[model samples]
Target: MSSTANISTRTPDQLGASRAKAADNSTGKTPGPHRSKHRRLWWTTLAVGVVAVIVNVPWFNALIVSFKSDGDISRGALALGHPTTDHYANSLGAAGYDFPRFFLNSGMIALGAVALVLLIAVPSTYAAIRLGFGGRFIMNASSALRLLPAIFFAVPYFLLMSNLGLLDTVPGLILANTFLNLPLAIILLGAGFRDVPIELEEAAQVDGASTYRILYSVLLPILAPTLVAVSVLVFIFSWNDYLFALVLSSSNATPITLGAANFVTSTGIRWGDISAATVLSTLPPVLFAVFAQRFLVSGLSAGAVKG
Candidate 1:
C-alpha cells in the first residue's frame, strides 16, 4: 500500500513538471498574434511605398529637369543645378513662346466642354433613368460608339466645322471635345441617376413639386458628388486632347496641346522649354484630381451601396 501511494505521488509531480516546462517554452519563444500581424502589415506598407516611389520617380525627374538649364540637363544630370524659372518666365513671356495665351485658350475650351457636357448629359441621363425612354438602346449605342475609332470622326467633323465656319475657334474645339466626352458622361451620370431611389423622387412629387423642381432640389443635391466626378473627368479629357486641337485650331486660337507641338519644329527642339510647358500644362488636371479624389471615392461608394 505504501509503494502504490508513493508511485501515485511521484507520477503527479512528474506530470506537473512536464506541464510547467511546456508553459515556459510557450511563453519564451512563441510569437504573439498581434506581433505577426504587425510584421505582415509593415512588409506590405514598405512594398507599396517602394512601388509608389518607382512610379513617381519619372515625374519627379521631369520636374527637376524643367528647372535646369539646357547644358546642365543634357549631361545626365538628375538634380536641379542653379534652379531657374527662366524656362517658365520665357515660356510665358514673348521671349520664349506664346504659352500664356495657349494656357488661357485651353482653359476656356476645357471649361466650356465641361459645361456643355453637364448641360446635355444631366437631362439626357435623367430621362434615360427616370422616364426609361429607350434607356437600354441609348446605353448600348453609346457603348458602340466607343468601338469606332476617333479618327473616323476627324474627316466628317472637319468638313462640318468648315461648313459652319467654326474651323480654328475655341467654340469649334469645345464642340469636338463635348462630342468625344458626351457618351462617357451620359453613361456615368445615367448609372448614377439609376442608383437614386425612386421613393425619394416620389416623395418630392407628393409635395406637389414638378419633375424639374424635384430634380433641381432633391436629386441634384444627392448627385452632387457624381457631378463633380464627371466634371473632373471631362476637364481632364478636354485638357489632354491633342487630336482635335491639332486638327482644328489655328494660330489665333491655338491651345497648349497644339502650342506644345510647335516646340518640335523643322529646326532643333527646345527640350527645356518643352519640358517646362509640359509640367505647367499638367498642373491643373493634377490639382483637380487631388482635390476631387475624396468626392470620387464617396460617390463611387454610395453608388455601390445603393446598387
Candidate 2:
C-alpha cells in the first residue's frame, strides 16, 4: 500500500528520532529545554511579584492610615483597630480644607494643560517628522528642556505671570503646566510619528488628499492610541504638579498638591488628615489610568515591533 511504501522511504535517522519523540510523549516526559524554560518563567514571575509587593508597602500603609482615627495613627500602628470615616469627613467638609474646590481646580488645570499640549504637540511633531520642518531643533530643544530641572524656569515664569496679572489664577497654572508638559508630549508623539510609514502619506496624496487631510484623516487615526497615552500622562503630571503650584499660586488657583499643605499647621503635621488628603488626591489619576489602560498599554507598545 501507499502508506507502507511512504513509511519505508524515511531515512533511518528520521525514523529513530520520530520513535524517540513518540516514546517520550507516551511516557509523559517533557523535553529538557521546555522544562527549563518553564522553570525560568516561574522564577521570573515570582521575582516580579516580590518586587511589586516591596514597592507597594508604603502605599498600602498610607491607605490603612487614611481610614484610621487620629489616636490610632499617632500610636504608629498600621492596624485599623477602629476604622472611621472622620478623616475623610474632615478632609472633604472641613471649612479651611475645601478639598472639593482643590479637586475642581486640579481637574480644570490638568484638562486644560492636556488640551494645550496635544493641540500643539500633534501638529508640530507631525511637521517635524514628516515634513522635516525644524526636526533637529525640535528634538534638541525638547531634549535640553528635559535635562534642565523645572525649577530653573520658576523665577522667569513667576515674573511673567505676575506682569500679565495671571498669578494665583487657574489660567496661570494651566499655562505653567502646559509649558512643563510640552516637551514630554512632543518627545512621545515624535516617536509615534517616526514609527508611521511614509508610504501611507504618499498614497493618500495620490488620492488627492492635502497634507492636512492626510495628517488628520490618515495619520491621526493610526496614532489615536499614542495620543490617548500622551493625554493621560500630561494630565497626571499636571494634576500632581507641586513646585509651580507652590510658587505661583496662593489661594484662588491652588491645585490639590498645594491644597494638601493645609493639613500641615503650626501645631504639627496631621498625619491622618494628610493621608486622607493624599488618598483623595490620587483618585482622579488612578481612575484615569484604569479607564485608559487598554489604549495606554497599546500606545506604549506601539513601536516595539515592525511589520
Name the regions of candidate 1 deviating beyond 4 angstroms: 1-36, 78-80, 94-96, 296-307
Which ten contiguous residues of candidate 1 have the minimum total lDDT? 1-10
TM-scores of the candidates are: 0.82, 0.79
CA shift at 307, candidate 2, in angstroms?
A: 24
Tens-place lDDT digits, model 2, residues 133-245 = 99589977986787799999899999999999999999999999999988877877887788788999999999999999999999999988678778888898899999999
State, as a TM-score between 0 and 1, how close model 1 is to the true structure.
0.82
lDDT of 1 at 69: 88
Best by TM-score: 1
